[model samples]
Target: MKNLERFLSEHQQLTRRHFMRLGAAGAAALGLWPLTADAAPAAPELSKAIETLEPYFTPREKFRDVSRGKPLPHSLPDEKKRAVGLTRETWKLEVISDPDNPATLRSPLTQKDGTALDFDGLMKLAEKHAVRFPKVMTCLNIGCPLGMGIWEGVPLREVIWLTQPRENLRRVFYHGYHNDDPQQMFRSSLPISRVLEDPFDLPPVILCYKLNGQWLDSERGGPVRVVVPEAYGFKSIKWLTQVVLTNLYHANDTYAEGNNDIDSWLKTFAATISVPREVKPGEPMPVTGYAQVGLAGLSKVQVWIQSNAVERPTGDPHFTTAPWTDAEILAPPKHWGALPDGKIPANTLGFDDATGQPRTWPMRLAKVHWAALLPGLPAGEYTLRCRTIDEKGNAQPMPRPFQKSGNAAIESVDLTVKS
Candidate 1:
């Protein structure tokens, strides 16, 4: 897979002229239960005891649900869905200007003369412009991710640019079904530039409808959802219903109320997956976890372990001078195990359609699952910590500490070796 990724990279570079393309957080204040080591949710499927390489694609249903809605759109009763006009048969998408303060581009894309987009219409559009790629969906404040998936969707620009949006459209903000209540609307925005252009070559903002090549089954934001690969989870509003091209230049995120740094980019972080509490003096202790590559990018994952009985380095809380060992980042998995036939769908973005392999290892804005085996420790508990070194060579939490932005704390665990 690593070789394949390298081949894909070199391939893209060599063919750059021919092909161009493409492509927070918060919790409590807005009613989100952030997942962390201590608060790990009961996702039996996601709990990997494997201490080696973690699975590449998470099962759609197995992905943790940290939904923000009161009665999550997918969890809504059939009658409730109908009452809110979210039933697949009757759901309609209104790509319009804010009615109260209409922008120059009003009702740019619509079915018939001016009808909202229906499910079938969205499907029809997908046939022409859908793309697929792996993305790690994580929370802003949490130290862990909800899960990863091969998200499939149509580029937002493809849908918005069809009619050639007119003037005064500074931003494009969207929202999903929220019980027709303004307070409950899980809304987010993007500078029109972020949507229409890939200035930094970041992943294209997509109107996602499928995961792991499977149609979302309600609970996973079926029918439609927004997938913003760069930003945090809040930006990917699910059960999408409306997309507004607004002249409003400022972001209109729902988490803005009490959340700090509503516009901060997601910071890179690492979370340990498995660390056995006890091991013998001559035994190899397996350690594993995943590192989230952020806008800063990722260089490598490192681990530090020291006997609990020994005096710690008092001045180095950040472990700047600690003995850290590099961990091996696992290549992409052999069998995705996500798709029905255990084969990636044809033409997954960032992948070589011919071999169905990703073009690179540790893709930016994705997770790099890592593993390491610790040498025999004589006795006593050991303070074990792991973190990621970003592309800039700065250690975890160095470049970006936990602020109003997000948590990038150095994660640690106490591992006891039986005497």
Candidate 2:
């Protein structure tokens, strides 16, 4: 196997034009057509195209474990038992919107008339118009935890359309049931444009009922939850129960009051590497990890390895000190899953059909796997670092602004290259 450093050095000289031509040919070789670089498709055409490709989308096999550690707000002992006992027929989803006051954002899932829909109702709509897509959910608190899953559900636009918001409505506020505890309540808001429009080629916000072909478990915020493809997990609002259309912008998220950016998009292409903590010299080491971005799907990932002595002598320790030369761009998985001999699975929804690049949606969610081979090094401690380039050409923040917070920082692993 070629060492990662050598692999990177070889491709580093390719210009953008050369890279694109190669990428197009590579995709074609895999039986996938490059997206047509023409005028944007109309909404109806876009919807039809997405619907046509829905059945061919492929999901990753390994589901990362990211369970919320605390007892969920509504998860009392009896409530837990009740949740487990509830069937699709017994479950209900409420949709609420206060067009009059817009200030009284009470209730979990409310509507203009204060009516509720049973699970069957939700399923009926989803069965007819549901879309299947992959989305990466990362906590806003930075390195808290993250997970990627295939979500199936009705578009929030369609669901909200059923309520027929008043003409003046400008925003939508939503939250999940918290055992009727005000103190435990968590909520977030979205611009009405986001709810109703498909700007930036973003996947529609979904009221997801199923994940990876299975009904969601409570631990994963199931029964039903909102899946915001562009934002952090906080905006996804698990245990989702209420959606209130208002004319004013409101940030009610419990964490938003402090340092969290409630409306921020998941813009960083950060990664987590899986490597041995220690390795012997001359030993062949395989480096692997996953990379993700908010809306701008990943375009490239680069990995570098350097000794500790090559320091910048200033700036962030985790970042500025590394010698990034000879870094190699990691390749994506050759086969996502079992596709026909010459066919490719739809792996992302953020791809712009017109430009063959990821859209610049602030919260567009997508992820990809990356792997490389690392050559044995001389006896010394070394750092392995990885960074990602998004479709929009945004490079990972060097010495990331929030390394301590773990948000979008270059991922580094320390290892002893022993003799």
Candidate 3:
């Protein structure tokens, strides 16, 4: 309870619009009638509601092919392309001694002291203690492809435990099978603590063998790959072949060397407003889109329509002009997606106690679907904008001056209210 209070205080940006939704959810959980906004539920009621809504706050375990309905790309660098004879059946993961330390001998997994385990041996170990979870991977670059998949494999920590790393180890560095050329190699390292210290709230780091219930394909960093849910895609090394525990931190991230900020926090409140490019005056403008955040979770999505420019106060250079008129808050769909046989839908709305009408949308989800109706606008040019606020009250980034590594700004669309 104290933790919940602290969390709420720290993230006071949860708008009043979501309070009724949460309150009603809590009432429904207790088998009592849903409360109304005018009734003003107490803090305990809201807290209970939050507890009932906890499952949706985390990443989904079931995989949803959010590849935007396209096939995976096969664009590995020429040097890293697979050889004709190489396949998952033929690939082997190398557990080698720390290359950074000259005194260390090769092969950490062998009892013989200098030999490494082959693919079959590693698989046997992984099979004994496999874990699976769904994670969303996004690239650090602004427009890089995004993907979500259910990853199945052994936790990297378990693998490290098998090797029995020395107490003084400070880092664990790993890389995939790039060409023998050192300069062309793509490698990254994590602090030894990050790999070994499992946090209760975050997903475990894994060496994935299967994605979306299928053997990982080479194009998606297959045979073996790292899945680091907390960081950007660059941290999830692909085509993984080696794991080396070291006492030094390596700065080999290709994107981090130049313009990108590798340490940037994953953007949590980005949203895209989907609307028609043109609409006739006096006609209903149907709006729908999706919102996503990091582990912090989403709170609410606010929409606005403005015709005149206004001044901004957030101090973000991108948000130089402001004035916005509020639009109706949309409702969340009853279910995340079509449920399979024997599965039940997860309700996302709370019913009104008196009339039994739904009062609000479920906002505490990683991905939320939202829709709104705009009625009867005079013929003119207008910008329809939408922004998401995280559970911690942080606003989505404002688009204008490009940020190489920052939260994506509120999404907006220009429309001609035709006569």
Candidate 4:
């Protein structure tokens, strides 16, 4: 079973690398709920929640439904997709001429905030450069973790470069669509160097136009959206009517406005993965789950396995004959984006903040899902847990001491078996 664990771990990292290579297209394929589906109209619960929180901090804007594109997947039949038709004509693309020029770009309808941009200006920017198609866009749906599309337009780096920022400009920010409401625009940010890098060389970031190869539906924020790599889905803002560049190093000021300070680099939370409870010892177990690098990339995933079992309904516990084994750390491949064929990139060696070794404290891997298996357990229940480290050597909080808004908590699953 240890061998099986090794195999599972290898494949999991591979899948994550595959995910990076696909970028926004991969996100589109991840899942896209049909816009026309007869979902119940908006509920009051959301507004009430937003209102209750208003007293403590700056008001936040409510996000609108902007996913109007078909999901990009290989399985769907051509007939199932809607025709792009003339709707495509209404949409246009844009690029920021100078990443640091930062005159400001926001929707024309926005009040004169000295930073709003109109569609015409956006198009003018795009005409100057070639915009890529099918970038991934997702939302951190509080109700349900789901993603969809709105054609995105912008070369992320161009906007970064436009700012003509100083070398210390280590962070990039993003804000979503909003009305007059304070929280109207969902805001987030990522490491500046990652996005500012050359996408063709590493393809760090890209914008999207069509979802599933069709024009985005208006309700789903047809005109434009954004896709970012090596990050959680939330950072990929939609209804991208605005692109702002600044030298300030800050998390989501919008989040700060909301009273809870959210770090731009979405922190990796602590989580767990258990060996499937249904499987018997010696049999191959299905190990699957997702992990994120916050605003960076995953570095390593470490698993701890013990033959001990906790007593059932009764309060008994006992260690198994197969004593706990040494911890296993599954290291991920160096690069997430596609690499030159035949060239194997080494994990960008790093050191744990606490230690100087290549490995960081609380282990970091570029991808997650490196497997862990307990072979030949005496037909008893066991536990499998994981901790993740990012390229920066930041580890997911095990019992995450504090309940930070963006903290990624470790997760675990139970294993039950009968021999």
Candidate 5:
């Protein structure tokens, strides 16, 4: 509890690059949930899903297929896209509850008189804190860059404290404003035990009012919103309005309704990037791209050297260490056809570039690494394979685990490594 309080106070403003810097110094630290108040730190445990899949721990050989996903729905522009403006007051803020009674805590963020919380006050509150690195922002699109920018706001824990909950509180829920009917609005939940449970907790889950250090336009969760450190972007809940606490499990939010589809455990899946599919060996090779897991943080990442010269798998191979040197070589002019669609439904993996076909398996991974291997004597053919492991032991699976939403799960990449 002491460590968690300190972490929340310090990291409420940590930036993505800084987090990466921390990773560079050492493998990322995993967030361990305490089973009981007296449990020792070394006692290892598995999440519900991990325990269920304990039978399928067969690690295998795989390759990295870079040109996997075509694009994302957000990339299509017409899907969930909406134009947001600088208008601030049009939005309303809400403060639900602390850690126990979500239903009874439901209420709008407002003044003592019950009027909605004003945008100006929210902005002022955001600026009062000392944020370290800017919050990283990434659109749901696969082809886009992982955006990094400063976010300003109060620690979400602070707000929760202000609302106050009963003594036996344990978890909390957050709901964001949605254009869909109130019943269909986007919402997610977090474990208060975890929120206030660590010492590294910095930049408390902020009630973000600014993005890139500027007031957010309505398009983004504007006027006000929630930013959590341990959950995925969806769980961050934009245009946030209410927060509730409950003792029982509630899986009825947007993603939860789909059995928590792409987001069940919050683990970032592994992927390989080879859109252009051709790279010259030698010279300064640029291996650029991003990888993400849900709430389970990233621990180690790996990229293999491959020559673009053959048909390959949809995803990248499992990567456990950096600077992969023993990667397989590829033959030149490899004519890989469209990614093979498998058990997981098509048009479900990732959207097709030409056609909006739901993607499958490896094709769902959006980002890839690019490399210009050391200058070579001859240029026959080559390919690259890549994969990642999160703080937890989970790796991106081959055929993504069966789920309603197509979000990738922990699995290894299977690219065709060539040279």
Candidate 6:
């Protein structure tokens, strides 16, 4: 009787649909439900068809964890506080100039003058100036992107001007919390122009905190990270701690020491997904993969297939003259599972505020997946390769042979059409 009374109290709050969903649980709680069978008949299908969509945002845990430190702070159980200062309540930020010159400013930025920004202060500033944008982060050396994300933060320009910095400062660099060892201190920089003003429609360099609508965790380079959309992932330092204005004229990126092109903007390229090795003749073979839209923008994804019997006339390693055909770039998802509530955030940069659609079809500085269908073939082995064409009319590895700037190579898959 008591169980019935308690259930009756809670059941009134549940919708008719949820009332059915919870009745079994209520029976279980009262020791009256079956051990295996469902409480009622299954409901009818909600939709006649389901659309396959590529994920828009990488889950925080699913994102590649490329954090660098002798022993990563998030990996150390008790020492996270001392190492990276975890948590939103305790976060702090500072934008300062070289100690010698003391920066040109409207508000004198002496720590004594209460100019250091706290987490609350940063949030207050974001009320008006916060911006969000989607970007796919690709490392210069790595052939694939680390991940794609909807990043939200105030532009670095907003933070710097609070200190009233000037063009006299040639560069601005920042680094995240790291192990105290000076040798492990990783830092990256951008030209003062890159941070202070927008040019060529580049996404403004931002000090970002939220990822996929959640407070960034320590493992993902939060309380804040600097996001430079036009540059490779190297330019976006993680676990941000300080912003320093400097007079040095040359790029001082730490990645430069590892013999990398410090300014290697991500290049347009494509790589294959799962392609079958053997298939019966007369069946439509689907080839699918993703393309990275670089600063040059992407016109289309191109694919070329040839049987193994065809001997290539030696000397064209980059395949400059391969007979290629266009593939279909997957359309915008009817539903965005990775986005919050399946709605594109209107505040996203470069997207229409009214409709929340991108101004350009395939957004630049991002990644788009594509697919092609191949007609059936008789018993034979063949190879299929895919590459992207940029808006400037250049194919993969065309304008750049990919020496050290960024990895620019065509990806291929082998398939066998059995009899």
TM-score of each: 0.83, 0.71, 0.68, 0.46, 0.51, 0.83
In model 2, the Cα lDDT at residue 162 comes to: 71
TM-score attained by model 2: 0.71
Could you arrange the candidates by lDDT from highest to lowest? 6, 1, 2, 3, 5, 4
The positional error of residue 218 in candidate 3, measured at the CA in angstroms, is 1.6
What lDDT tens digits, residue by residue, belong to model 1 across residues 201-256? 67688888788877776787767888887888888888888898888768888778
Candidate 5, residue 266: Cα displacement in angstroms equals 5.9
CA error at residue 323 for candidate 3, angstroms: 6.6
lDDT of 4 by residue, 255-299 (tens): 456445343334453243333567665553434334543444555
lDDT of candidate 2 over 150-239, digit per residue (tens): 677788877777765556577877877676667667777788888888777667888888776668666567678888877777788777
Instruction: Please say which candidate is ahead in lDDT: 1 or 3.
Output: 1
Note the clash tally of each candidate: 2, 16, 4, 50, 69, 0
Clashing pairs in 6: none
Query: Relative to the unseen true structure, what is the Cα RMSD of model 5?
Result: 19.6
Residue 203, model 4: lDDT of 30
- For lDDT, candidate 1 versus 5, the one ahead is 1
Model 4 stretches with alpha carbons more than 4 Å out: 1-152, 156-221, 227-235, 242-252, 258-260, 266-275, 281-284, 294-299, 306-369, 389-395, 398-405
Question: Candidate 6 lDDT (Cα, whole model)?
Answer: 0.71
In candidate 6, stretches whose alpha carbon ends up further than 4 angstroms from where it belongs are 1-53, 82-84, 99-114
Could you tell me the TM-score of candidate 3? 0.68
Model 3: lDDT of residue 33: 41
